[model samples]
Target: MQFRSIAMAIGMTALIGATLLAPVTAAEDVPPAPLPSQSLAPLVEKTAPSVVNIFAQKVIRNRSATRYLDGSAFWRLFRDTLLFGYGQDRFESSLGSGVIVAANGVVVTNYHVIEAASGILVALPGGQVYSARVLVSDQRTDLAVLQIEAGGAALPSIAFGDSDRLKAGDRVIAIGNPFGLGQTVTSGIVSATARTSFGVGDFRFFIQTDAAINPGNSGGALIAMDGTLVGINTAIFSTSGGSQGLGFAIPSNMARVMVDGAVKGQTLVRPWIGLSSRTVVPQIAELLGLSSLHGVLVTDVFKGGPADSAGLQPGDVILAIDEFPVDDPQALRYRIATRAAGSTVQLTLERDGEFHKIAVSLQLPPNEPARNESWMPNLSPLRGARVASLSPAFADEIGADSGISGVVVLEVRIGAGAYRLGLREGDIIRDIDGRPVRTVDDLLTFRTTPFKSSRITLERAGSVLTATRN
Candidate 1:
């Protein structure tokens, strides 16, 4: 029976092959189909000139050879000692990619690419290298704009495309310097759009693609088939330090905002609506009598802010921004942030099972109740830390809860008391020795006051932590 079955399978395979090999007859009436271009050569030729390699060199300083042993008695003793020449400085270099956005030598790249670099070099095609200076660097968006002197000559640049129109399954190509290999191109479709929660930057909205974005691809161009820039390749999710088909890019719409700020010699201050919200889940949708799980639930609205002025109340469901559906809080924030300040945007909202439209003017976060920043004295427990009174504007800038009132740490010096005690920037000093620290003056009072068994209570990243020095 086994031999018979094997013979039957072989006969079936032979019959299928013979049938496939046979030529079609006139009765088939099949016509030839057209083929695609089968080449991205034209697109590459038009877009490759805008992509460039970036080299940044940062200076490293050490007080001692054993500077890694910071905060130790031995480190302090050997620090600044001539025997080891530990005070010498060293240079650390990194490589990345950039895209030319303007004909007048303006380039855009990731902020992390040139962060703290003493010098930066932009290498164009054909071995031409030019010194570049940072015009502006925005940490929140992780985007930076640089100006290069091109001897007053126009440089090739790629035009920005409408990233808002980009959808999943759209063909795209990534041009970058992957792993220091100069000027490589990889093609893939956009895996997803409006992706969030990857933790790449303050703005969580991202364009996810399966293109081979590896190290050095950051700041490179993600070009559409029309030879226009759609996004700036910024990050990759991989376990082996290489592209695993999971890559994220900053949409061109966001990059355009940075470029515009750079051209105007202005800082990139994103417009804020002065509200907090959460994504509407299934349970929320049912409770709110929604047809589907769409839009975000407004959790809080700052008094006298844009949302408040526009008659937005807590428990209101924001359905869309200017007709663009915002299914999550990140999408809503991104849409609002990309628009210029002072511009009015129409919002669609649902309240009491009824839909309504309201116009709200976008504005910069108000800096009311002034920061009144203060630096701690050497005798204070938070010595070498810059503390400021928390205001709604300041809180928004530092990504802290505006509802909380306290002194927030703006900066912490290395090897200082605050550094040794694990105090860091963004930490809100709730109290010192159970004394409420609501203002910078409240913290400054501790500099001259004497307290036994120092205990500090602070809030960092939404968690309350206590640090004590006994």
Candidate 2:
């Protein structure tokens, strides 16, 4: 009995030990692994559903033949039917990419894509094609929405990621129809953000990436790793018509604004204060008693534009707009574009060593009647005023001061902010709040959305006119 009892105790102890150590053994098997910094697989898989191949065609009166505008016998006879094809010419056939934004077939693409398209065809990921109709386009934002007629057809859509939340070095994936190769995926990191000169549509803030974006990738999806759409692939920094690891996309934040406005045929009227601008330069700064050359310098103010109507003037330095800080021209543009027209905006600016607050309500750009010309200017950047540097001889002829150097106001758009400032052909813009203007690039770099009000100090006919757009 004693021997049997001892054997039973030993067996019970052994069983208890095994039970206690079993949990520990399982825990040791996993051991901890380092967290992953990035992944493109999820981005490609999830975002690809929203990207669609876009093909558009429009019947346009072919303008292949030339006719003199002087209206000669040959010109008048052929102008209507021969030079410009009367009815039979098919003027457009183009390919691009688009992202499905709605489960009911609402799609988003670059404005230029379907601006002139008489017919639009959208191809789904599984190789299904459907007809589309353009809802509306905001030229200022370069954003357009299309409506597909597949009511009962289940469509894959994308969710908008906060582009404002993206940072440099974040991993991103681009899926598009590059060179019309159907659906293609490329990977890269956000190299930079908010570059202005890419000129994709009318938007300014951008997510710059090293992704391999090529032609036909316009309006494609640029997404974060978790499949959130951060941007729309639009333009590339290529010299040879191929990807050079430098591409730009429209941030999804702006895309959302445009897409929302385009829904159900609503118009997107971007807020405008109405003024022409040039960048403040070292010379302009010194001439105007400014310590630093920063912010957009108002070169001209419209006579009745928001700036002119509100007492904002020429030569005022605009430092910030709507509480968003700005130092570059592009920054101002980003701030303005992110707002709706007729919205009230405030600026903080310095004038004569004192800061001022200017409140102004924005206006929509004036409408232009449709022209018969082929919609080829859909992507052109010279959509605004024509400008060049002012000549000393011209200044002297206009009785303007010789030291006031700036580009000439050769043309004032009828409804532009500058034209409303009573800006005519002869005004010599001397300085922008202690800064100087000299070149077109200087003007391009000039930003006004940051300032509370724009001030312009120009010399005209021996009198210095300081106009303020408040």
Candidate 3:
């Protein structure tokens, strides 16, 4: 998700360190090292002025405390600053970055940075912080647009580039505040293209670079050599606490779609077919009596969902969605999420050794988040249903109150212990093995410690009940 924690950062840095570029040779090996970047001066001078730093402050309605009773050195520091504020007591605060894209100070940044924000400010290179208003935010792509009243004053701005034409090895520059270092810049070559990390969003297309991006770099500009905004600096792929140089940016093309809609006060729609797919292997290809394994194999179709209503079924190989080829599962998702919600989708599917077309009308995700946030972790589990330990955000979705606790079921295998007991998705198990379960670790401990026939108690709406799986 949004990367954090020193230990997590350190691990990511170590992972990316192994992939860093080789060092330049001294003396005769090379006539002279290539310039730190080929013609970077002109690019920086053109775009740096438009890349602004975003400062947004908001109150998180129900945030969890950073400290537990453990009282470790880490918690003690958190206690001093967060809980007690060392004594004076301060309120909750969140910070991130942004970029200027219009002469009138129209700016863009991650939607998360401004969620529930009461105040937003845009900081120019000269340290002039201008008050800004959120025009709109698209949670699907995690992109938001804010406008600073430029009035008659001239503000620096950058033009968006054709992100579809981007190629690997293209030189890029990132400008933002890394760890609160104001207006810092880092340069690197594009590491990979069309990369997918579902962690960023359910639908995916990222511009990967080796630029040294950090926490405060969110919502910054990923500029190309021609001084165009190619992408929005977003997340990093790291295991260590610091940047080992693997950074990701949201392509300008996708960002443009949301920005255009936001400016018009229109919500983007997404079409859905209600099917889960898996990459087809050679074995599966042969089993399906297919000549190749290029298409996405439909593995599960939710009963009574759009796909089912449209006569789409499991074992159907999806070849295409509209014009874009369904070459990968992520492509299918990307195509749909980018479409207007409630629109009918024309899908090419191969079923019963015959290929044909079907149009399925899209439905809004049933459990869309309060801010229209995307999917939550699946809580269908073997141990009396599951909840995810990933984020505290989903705790309330499963009927969990403030003190509720447990490892959420990310997935539930059919015929498993919990499935056989009539437990379904969105069930929150408050107690396991007769002990109040608060985390995944607690459930795992009970799984091995002479525990059997668990007396599981769960909260489904206002009712609480027990189930047994011997």
Task: Count clashing residue pairs per candidate.
Answer: 0, 43, 20
Q: Please, what are the lDDT tens digits per residue for candidate 3 over residues 1-470? A: 44568779988898788667556567796576666755677777878888777777765432233333444566557756776644222346566788887787778898877877888878888777788898877665778888897675889888888876788998889988888777888999899876865368545678899998998899999998888898998888779867887898988877776776667777543344566676678898999997678788886565566778998777899888874567666666666655665788889878878889998887754432122222222342354344454122343233222223344454555666667875666565667667876555555455523444557787654356677766
lDDT of 2 at 379: 25
Q: If candidate 1 were superposed on the true structure by all CA atoms, what would the RMSD be?
A: 9.3
Error of 3 at 63 (Å): 10
RMSD of 3: 19.4
Where does candidate 1 stray beyond 4 Å?
1-35, 65-87, 282-292, 374-387, 401-470
lDDT of 2 by residue, 1-470 (tens): 99999999999999999998775556668878989755566557766877999999977764434433444455556756675634235567899999998888888888777767888999999888999998876555566788888867879999888887788999888999998777999988999876766755543667899989999999899988767888888788888999999999988978787777777456555545666555677898889887677777776665556777877777888888866666655566567666677788898877886778898887764322111111112121212344555543333233233223465555555655665655666565556656775645555555565546667676665456886656
Residue ranges of candidate 2 with Cα displaced over 4 Å: 1-38, 60-92, 138-141, 152-154, 199-205, 303-305, 308-311, 328-330, 356-359, 363-470
Number of the predicted model whose lDDT against the real structure is largest: 1
| TM-scores for every candidate against the unseen true structure | 0.77, 0.64, 0.60
Mind giving the per-residue lDDT tens digits that candidate 1 earns over 1-470? 99999999999999999999998788548676768787999999999998999999999976554546754766555654644645557799999999999999899999999999999999997688999999999787889999998788789999999999999999999999999989999999999998987898887889999999999999999999888999999999999999999999999999998899889999767787878787899998888788678898887687788889999998899999999899877788789878998999999999988999999998887776689988898878789999899876787677676545689999999999889999999899888888888788888788534555788898877568998865
- How well does model 3 score by local distance difference test? 0.70
Error of 2 at 217 (Å): 0.8
Residue 452's C-alpha lDDT in candidate 1?
A: 55
- lDDT (CA) per prediction: 0.87, 0.72, 0.70
